[model samples]
Target: MQYGFLYQFFFYLFGVIGVASAITFVTRKNPVAAALWLVNTMFCLAALYIMMDAQFVGAVQVLVYAGAIMVVFLFVVMLLNLGQPSAAADIKGTGARIAAGVAGLVLVAELLVLARQKLPPLLPDLPRGTNITVPITEPLFRQYLLPFELTSILLLVAIVGAVVLAKRRG
Candidate 1:
């Protein structure tokens, strides 16, 4: 389907905002601030996903990642008293800084290569009026059922562990 200028405009707008928010997330010194920025980035990504015709995935992204995961992260941060100045250490020293710079350069190179790829659209080439979630939910529940259950169990374990650790330390 032929898209108009507005489609492209919103796509690029969300894309740029996503990238900028992700950078802000990384550069933040406070873990809570960083997580909030990360949530903003996730929202931008969800918008992009919706724009690309993946409504279910976008909704899941917002609900699961931004809502659930970030809430867990912030809860853990608060439980562990991470608001203290000494809770995190800066990446000091010339060697560590140089290593970080090299890693950043490698990431930039990978992104450049990814940008050159002519990838297909995420959704299938079905009629625009078709229900998209039916195709996705089938395999997600059938083929990937085990992994999905395992992921939930893992998250439960993580939460329990965090609580146990916090209680012990307190």
Candidate 2:
């Protein structure tokens, strides 16, 4: 029927898939399976971005996160020959699990408080045909240039480090 209705439907569906994928990513014993789950999660997020009308962000999410980042993850998994299932003994203990659960609850509470305080009310009707490209891009390149470059460099370094760690020592 309406575009907004379709968008909302897909949004909820993808959101559920994203959460499921994230859980699978964490719980899967196989490295490849975890990476695959992560990739699925990224794709769902990209779909959500598209539903929000952030075309540039959606494309970047798919291209950079789902495509490039997942490729790197898969490469590392393959290079390390992480084919075997993780040993059952490597799982965390009950005390660590309790601590992690408590930490997660605290984080959720903090996020809820922050969201309640900072989020503006959604406008009933956003201005039609509004263009945000220049507004968004100009500041990203001009004001945040250094931080952006640094982030890219940091990611590159992480990739290199992963490669080095996975390589066989001569």
Candidate 3:
């Protein structure tokens, strides 16, 4: 059907864009550019998650990673006035090239092995409706209550430590 073909096309397109954006995130010299690329990459990943029928995950990916994290990164970059133009650095020296080549080979080998394995099929009778109605915080407070409280306590301690350190004078 036409819909199936369109879905497949978009799936591959978004996947390729995600990978390209990830590479750009790491390779871009400017911090702001890297953060922007990271946001783009997160958006692409959210698209991929939607294609896989995980609507909640996709929305959270955009809301948390792309929106919140990238906003914080951009704000910090702006506050610090990190507007320096990207300088071209030597990235293809022999040692660096060799290390990159080895990493690529390892990744390719892992992919090949995974491709050879047969994945289990999803249940045919499973619900197709996207469950986006439930708020994530509800489960965190109800089911994962203890862990959530502990994490908040840990974060508070970290914030207090940071403030104490910043206030110390010579």
Error of 1 at 16 (Å): 0.8
Q: List the residue pairs that clash in candidate 3.
A: none
Off by over 4 Å in 2: 1-3, 107-118, 123-133, 149-170
Clashing pairs for predicted structure model 2, backbone only: none
Compared with the true structure, the alpha-carbon lDDT of candidate 2 equals: 0.84
| Reference-based lDDT, each prediction | 0.88, 0.84, 0.83
TM-score of model number 3: 0.76
- Taking all chains together, each candidate's TM-score versus the true structure is 0.77, 0.75, 0.76
Give me the overall lDDT of model 3. 0.83
- Clashes per candidate (backbone, < 3 Å): 0, 0, 0
**Model 1 residue 23 lDDT score:** 92
lDDT tens per residue, model 3, 1-170: 23488899999999999999999888877888888899999999999987776677898899999988789879878877985644667256899889999999999999999999998866442265534545555787899999999999998998899779857486
lDDT by residue (tens digit), candidate 2, 1-170: 34587677888999999999999898888888888899999999988886776767888889998888889878867877876786665568999999999999999999989887956665453356766476568888999999999999999999899789968899
Q: Rank the candidates by TM-score, best first.
A: 1, 3, 2
Q: How far is 88's C-alpha from truth in model 1 (Å)?
A: 8.5
Compare the candidates by TM-score and give the number of the best one: 1
lDDT score for candidate 1 against the true structure: 0.88
Which residue runs of candidate 3 sit more than 4 Å off their true CA positions?
1-3, 86-97, 124-130, 133-145, 161-170
